[model samples]
Target chain A: MDNTNEKLGVGLLYNASLPEYLEHNIEQVDYIEIIPDMFWSDEGRNAYPRFVDLPQWRHQLNWMAKQVPLVAHNIGMSLGTLNYFDKGYIQFMKEMNESYRFRWHSDHLSFIKLPTKGPHDHNAGIAIPVPYDKDYLAMLREKISFITEQIELPFLIENNVYFVEYPDQDYSETDFINQLVSTNDQANILLDIHNLYANSVNHKLKARQYIDELRMDKVVEMHIAGGNEMGGMYMDSHAGPCPDEVWELLDYAVSKAPNLRGITFEFHESYFPLLRFDGLNKQIEMAKAIWNKYTLQPYYHELA
Target chain B: MNSPDFQLAFATLIASPQLCKQAIADEPSVFDQFALTEKEKTRLRSVLRQKGMSICCSLYRMNRITPLYTQLTQTATLLGDELITLAEEFWESYPDSSLQFKEEVLAFGQFLLAKLEVGTLKFPYLQEILRLELAINELSYTPAIIEKTVHFDYDIVAILLAMDRGTLQTERLQKVQVAYKVYLEEQTLKLALL
Candidate 1:
């Protein structure tokens, strides 16, 4: 099946160094989403994804897995880039999956490669977006298909934020996503509301318009988070409280994405200190209220 | 645009605002370096014209230098105006960055150490500071014991310990014989003076 049969309610992105406040509120979160890239160091450029000197991180990840259901949210897999692929990064994911037995795994829909990954592939220093076009879609199809064959769990590509405006193309951003789903059966959308909200504001588009247009059934998981505003531009900085605009979009989106299994709250570690304990719980509580509603239906599976 | 050309264009334009402007102006000579197709060049021009490319550069520069600022506070403070120039040179020398932050940082330290040895870097304390920072990184990333001998008017150990231990930075003009040992225990590097 394209989507998971199990259910995953509201969860918090787990960093080993979570605030002391969250320790008391651990039970408030249903599950934890772990970004493997954060825990393991891919030793220098040509080391080919070798884990380096992260003994403490390995211990923490092992401990966290025993506590609750842990899902792998990968930040390193640059699935959209076509020419060169990081076979080592793929291998790392496979090894991690074997150890953690993550219910599912996801990566950003952007390209982030080490210099050694390809010839003439300059490092972008950040997870920048890929172009929206038919050839681009074809590239993703082949890459994603290979990933699906290698990793058994359901894989998702989170809707990433892009600052660049490509010249007009055959597909809108929504159309590009829809085509991606049509290409691979196991592939699904990780629908990041905050990213969508940021893109809408930055590009002067409608959140509702894109949400209604997308094939919501393909959305197996969703993400919501807060970001910082620098120089009048809303960034996907993942810095602070969930913006009102994202929450507003979430209120409308929850009903539309019927197959949605998980809704994760993402915030960077630097921003953890800026957020109050009460505020974090309220965001979880808000997600719970919505999860509690849809979960009442027969369509929603039991929480894993 | 094909993936290779597009990826190359992104890397070039993001790293250099001057190239973005050149590409925007339809300067074939500038974008030819990136192997950009005519269509890719046009799209890149459109995007860079939106003025977000500068923001991208700023955001990336901030992420890159954040660790340097935190770890090399004294070095950065001492260099002041030259720090930016040093960083740009380092970036040019080693364009590829690792996701492992300490790797990127240690590489910069290595670059400085090379510069210092080659007489390209002229500073009173460059050698000592680079040695101390690189030693800390070495200790963190590996358990291999490090033994070194050096002489200086200032106490390098005291300044390093002060950064984390809050010990006061004491100034003493003395050429003292000392042995330095560094190793990791419980995620903290233990520096022993013998």
Candidate 2:
């Protein structure tokens, strides 16, 4: 969804370690994408004022909001969750948008929270991939429609990294995404290049071919990350700095995605030592180098 | 047949590799609770057969324990190898996690306390470590200015430092009973010996 055609330029997914990095190298960051769930502790489904702000995290966010454009990359929505949609979460995001003025928001096209009859829902602890079937597509469309209605900003759906694939599915991942984005002009894609790489290595599929099949124009943002091999499979660990192959794929993806607004580099906070400030700056520089080649001149470099 | 049923089954399998094994063994009763279609059952059964299923379970375990280890570092360190068995037992008993960091950390702390009280899990200084970590965690999340005193039968600060340095000598540790104050100062958790 093109809420604003203005490009977001290079972005970094905010993690626990970025506070130190941002202290000295804030200039290197064009934008900061925050996972909002990290900034608060939800007491439960039944607590009064359920969302309690983490003072330290909020203090950091409040400062960052003034320095650069802040976009939200949420993990809590679990939008692909079947038979249940978290309207309260969407409402909270609306409140967050009011506070941070997020240019756009996105979440994975997977389910993490499994609702039950208990006092609290069960968290799957990992993003479980949604089956690419018509029923799921319909469910996602309804949920996205509800979200966009509640929050007018552009909403992007990130592709999932699957360790195992369902045997029979209605559509390919690309086909499912294309169909989902067709729901409305406000719905779009956040393509993750490393997820494609992990899937390619594990499932022995062509990453470029998957990209080729995707509707590139719907790709409003792209995620570049690194992964590690685990249990005889390439896992999308987001370990640290992007691999050479992912940068190459990002180069290809940027070339094809004419409407791309942002390129986010993600790494887990625990790997901060592996990606010291220098490593982070290099990733940003490389993404900007690719972004500069394909995007128009002088995009939204900072919040004005 | 339905997505929720499939999701619940998948989530159950992730949380319990025992059930994943049961499903892999083609034990029909493993998924009897879910009203799944024959195709759904077959797909889940096939998924359990894949090597990636092990990865899935392992990843789930890693994620599940992250908040615990990150928030309760000293307690986790003290538990060491015993954490694996204790965590599995805790999950088996208290299967649902709110996924809230505060909730998970606190829940695990309470679970350990219950185990210690029941004499199932034992350690000389486990209670002090768990209680100290729990207090710090609670203070970190407490928005209002609050203070609480936690009493330790041993020198916890030295023990935690030794634990961090990997030089803890349980027998040589000081047996001084001390009270440490945990409170929030300037939005950060602070600890002081009183």
Which prediction has the highest DockQ against the true structure?
Answer: 2
Clashing pairs in 2: B1-B37
Candidate 1, after superposition: displacement of residue A94 in Å?
Answer: 1.2
Q: What lDDT tens digits, residue by residue, belong to model 2 across residues A43-138? A: 777777878888888999999998999999999999878888878888899999988889899999999998878757789988999988888888
lDDT of 1 by residue, B1-194 (tens): 46476776686567766666767776676666767777887777677777567778777677778768766666776577899999988876666665356676787888877888899988655566676666666555543334334444456675555544543334333445455565556756566665
Clashing pairs in 1: none
* Candidate 1 chain A worst ten-residue window by lDDT: A114-123
RMSD of 2: 3.0
Q: How well does each candidate superpose onto the true structure, as a TM-score?
A: 0.89, 0.95
- What docking grade does candidate 2 earn? medium
- Per prediction, fnat is 0.40, 0.72
DockQ, computed on Cα atoms, for candidate 1: 0.46
CA shift of A144, model 1, Å: 0.9
> For candidate 1, what is the DockQ-based docking class?
acceptable
Off by over 4 Å in 2: A1-3, A297-304, B161-167, B172-177, B186-189
As a whole number from 0 to 100, the lDDT of residue B168 in candidate 2 is 75
